[model samples]
Target: MKFLDQAKVYIRSGDGGAGSVSFRREKFIEMGGPDGGDGGRGGDVWAEAVDGLNTLIDYRYQQHFKAATGGHGMGRLRAGANASDIVLKVPAGTQIFEEDNETLVADLAKVGDRFRIARGGNGGFGNAHFKSSTNRAPRHANPGQPGEERWIWLRLKLIADAGLLGLPNAGKSTLLAAVSAAKPKIADYPFTTLHPQLGVVQVGNHSFVLADIPGLIAGAHEGHGLGTRFLGHVERCAVLLHLIDVTAEDPVAAYRVIRKELKAYSPELAAKPEVIAFNKTDLLSTEAIEDKLKDFKRRVRKTPLLVSGATTMGVPAAMKKLLEVIDASRRGDRPADAPGITTEEWRP
Candidate 1:
């Protein structure tokens, strides 16, 4: 199925039914009293989070949702039937917003979450309700109330344990395909992966979900080169794995560009635990790799792992390092200065 993360919908609740105005006329009875019955209540509009769905593509074709109107009342003290409610089933991690798109209405982060978006109108009173000692034999009834109507926005954010970050053709997709069962499109051109992709990575006996989003470039936070549209998928990650191509013309410049975009998008995102790695080492010889690693370490001032996604070299060490940081984060024991892992020290 095609992926869709955002949608705009229009919804309306049902209107109440009208009350009846009638009097009983029985045989051999000299006096008859008002016997008009009351109207039933209208249906409501609700939203619920369910399982087995990860996209909002279902909302692309249909955008309007309306509840059924209540039945009208009848004579001889016969009340009207109530209308059934309408429930919209959305995927987990879906957020609802008002028409302005800034004011949040609800956040369904987990399954089985529910919220009432619109309430049904109340029923009207019958003529018998107004009948009293002074006002006997009443012949009037009340009208039903109107329902509410409004437009809303729905946004989805995927949940994962770790997110892959890098520039276009930086070997992120290659790394994901090598490590997990996800078949992300891999090509030499930029932006081969248009949407976010998730994979289940098994490290040792433990497993976790890994997310791969579209590559980022300069000015990505301000709507350049796919913009920050897919960045929201990583907001729930425990750790981030930043991959930089070893064969790039300026690896240091590439690192700085990604870092700047992360900080520009969100400060909290920038503060998340990150693990940097130099990928595509298969293209370089042993001596060339050593020389490049020395210069990169000196310029960046941070130790980075060396790996080749195409040949799966030094990949196990990198996965183990990522799992370690994820475990530390989950246990709430991540240190302020977590040490970086190198392939030489932690070979798998």
Candidate 2:
């Protein structure tokens, strides 16, 4: 299935059935009274979050959804059957918005979450309902109310424990592939990964979901490159893993560029706990790695880890640090101290 994070759809509820108009007649009775029954209610339109779905691609094919109309009333005081409701199944983390796309209508963040999108029109009244002592032969009835209709937008934001952030070709994808089962497209060129990718990384007895999004470049918030459109996928992450290519002309500058973009996109994202790492250390010698790590710590004002995504070097340390932050975040006791990296080698 293709990944579709956003989609626009039109929906309408079913109309109510009309009420019946009838009068009872008996051979032995001199006069008979009206006995029309009420019409059935119209069907409703609802949206529900369900399991086994991760994309909104299904909505791309079908944009219009409507509920069944209520059955009309019949003579002899018989009421029509109510129409069945229409339910829309969507993946977890799907957010529903108005046509403008900014007005949030609902956020289906977890499975079994549901919301009503539209209501069916009520059934019309029958002539028998107008009968009274003064007006025994009433002949007027009310029309059924109309159903509601509207156009809405659906946007999906992936849920993950940690998110990877870096510049293009910073080895973000390599790290994800090395530590998890996710097979992201890898290339020496830029923008090799177009969409967001997810993987589950298990370290020791603990496991957490990791998300990797397209790399960010300078001025990404101003529509530069892929822009910050994919950042939404990582908004819910507890911590951010920022990787910088040690071979880059200036690793500190690369780090700063990504930070600037994050702040420009969202303050909350920028404030998330970040673990800095120097990737592609396999290409550098031990001495060179030590020098760069010191420089990074001095300039970035935080301790940085050295890891080689291709060789799976120092990956366990990275994963461990990420899990630490994730656990702290979940308990609402986010560590106030700066993030630190462990140099000791540990196998996953």
Best by TM-score: 2
Q: Where is the poorest 10-residue window by lDDT in model 2?
A: 339-348
lDDT of 2 by residue, 27-142 (tens): 99766888777777788888888999999999999999999888887777788888898988998888889999999788787788888888788888787888888999776666
Give a tens-digit lDDT track for model 1, residues 43-143.
88888888999999989999999998877778888888888988888888888899998897887777887777887776777887789999998889987
Q: How does model 2 score by TM-score? A: 0.92
Candidate 2's C-alpha runs over 4 A off are 333-348
Residue pairs that clash (backbone atoms under 3 angstroms), model 1: none
Question: CA lDDT, every prediction?
Answer: 0.87, 0.88
lDDT of 2 at 151: 100
TM-score of 1: 0.89
Q: Which whole-number lDDT from 0 to 100 does residue 90 have in model 1? A: 89
Question: Considering summed lDDT, which 10 consecutive residues are worst modelled in model 1?
Answer: 339-348
In terms of lDDT, the best-performing candidate is 2
